[model samples]
Target: MTPEPTLAALLARLDRVEAHQAVADLMSSYINACDLAKDIDRIVEHFTPDAVWEGVGRNIEFGTWQGREAIAANFRGVQERQPFTYHYLTNQEIRVADDALSATGRWLCFEPSTIREGTLPVWIGLAYDNTFVRDGDQWFISHLAVDTLFATPYDKGWGVEMFTPVTAPKEPSHA
Candidate 1:
């Protein structure tokens, strides 16, 4: 007799691996876009219409943006001194849980901005406590918290936006 693989067994196997990499990839693009734009509207769409983005930004900036309007406004506020900026995400450590439906990850945040003279990059590695959602036919970050652990200023005088026709990064490689 041939062996039949049970459906429950397959799903259980699926739960063993992280399922939020796609979401992470999409989110990385969002972060990149925000840094690229002189304005924040372009990247604000990634968040939910009523999403709240709060963190210890300049002057201890932290608040809950009610919706698209509020979120965009808040980003614009922080982006005032951001014509020259870089948002780098790396060293990602992802964790899967809740039967392959939810997951979390750690991301190191780096920014190259002006401090005194020439531009220099500073490391502000932080923990990205995130929650994923299977939205429609794809995954999205339903909730994301960026907790800052370390930060320092640069001295190279961050350069103005210099991207020559930006293109989205390639999709997440599962290989």
Candidate 2:
């Protein structure tokens, strides 16, 4: 015969479940702010004051940004370069610490972006490794490391070319 779970065990399980959901929600909110709202303030609010955002692999050119202000600047640069983007995240795995004060998460991202003043369509594949710290009841990203799998033009695809040529749009003619 099986015994019922103790009240303390049930509460612990509930806390873990809630923590997982909170972390997932935070990621979703961040993506929405970047993709849909394009609100730099909203995006930066997801991170801790001293958070570190770093890009690796094929995206090493992005470099690293530490602190909320730096991260906001990085996002602003991205906004200018890619005016439109849709980010989709999948295969998310989040593990809450036993103490429930911190967590780690991994996600795979597929992003379709329009760049060069909507003249170029590009596809970006990325892997994200993130750490979150809990402050009271709220959680904020402490470190976010993204590795780019590929960033290829839609027409050429990554199989043919690893990345699309990034060029500024031609200026309007004054005649």
Candidate 3:
């Protein structure tokens, strides 16, 4: 017969499981808050005080913001630009550290958005790479890096032709 785990061993296993769940919950809450776009404070609370948020890829202007306040502002800016947005996340993978106090996760996101004055609704696919930190008993996002895979108008589906990166030609230098 297999020997039963000691109390300390069981507790360690529980801590790792809890850490994984916490990371998952944090990501879910982030997407929910963004979709609602009503409570910025609620979204800001998910991040650490010195957290960093970065967005890269072709659809939108790439930018990085540091600190909770800056991250909150970035989210607010997104809300302002996209009047309505529905975000979907899938294929999430979280890796908990041995200490059970930190973790890293990745998720795939599909976002359909309605712009304030735009005639066509836009759809975006992106990847999220996140780092989570546990402070006391609460887990917060330490870093969120988003890589936009594709952005297309709903009328025009995302196909082979849309695989190319969106780019703008550089302007002529006056000098």
Best by lDDT: 2
What is the Å distance of residue 46 in model 1 from its true position?
Answer: 1.7
User: lDDT per residue, candidate 3, 30-143, as tens digits?
Assistant: 888878755789888898988888776655545787887877776666666566778899999999999999999999988887654344477778899899999999999998
* Deviation (Å) of 28 in candidate 1: 1.4
In candidate 3, where is summed lDDT lowest over 10 consecutive residues?
Answer: 166-175
Per-candidate Cα lDDT values, in order, are 0.54, 0.86, 0.78
Two-way lDDT contest, 1 vs 2, winner = 2
Model 1 lDDT per residue over 1-175, tens place: 9788799877776654435556677678778777665556666666666555555333222444545676667556555433356767878877667566656666777665432222334433345665655545455555666665544543312243222111111221111
Q: Rank the candidates by TM-score, best first.
A: 2, 3, 1
TM-score per candidate, chains pooled? 0.64, 0.88, 0.85
Q: Which residue pairs show collisions in model 1?
A: 118-156, 118-157, 119-156, 119-157
* Steric overlap count per candidate: 4, 0, 0
- List, residue by residue over 1-175, the lDDT tens digit for candidate 2: 8899999989988888888999999999999999999999999999999998887666434577889988888787778888999999999999999888899999999999987767789998889999999999999999999887878999999889887665432331111
The model with the greater lDDT, 1 or 3, is 3
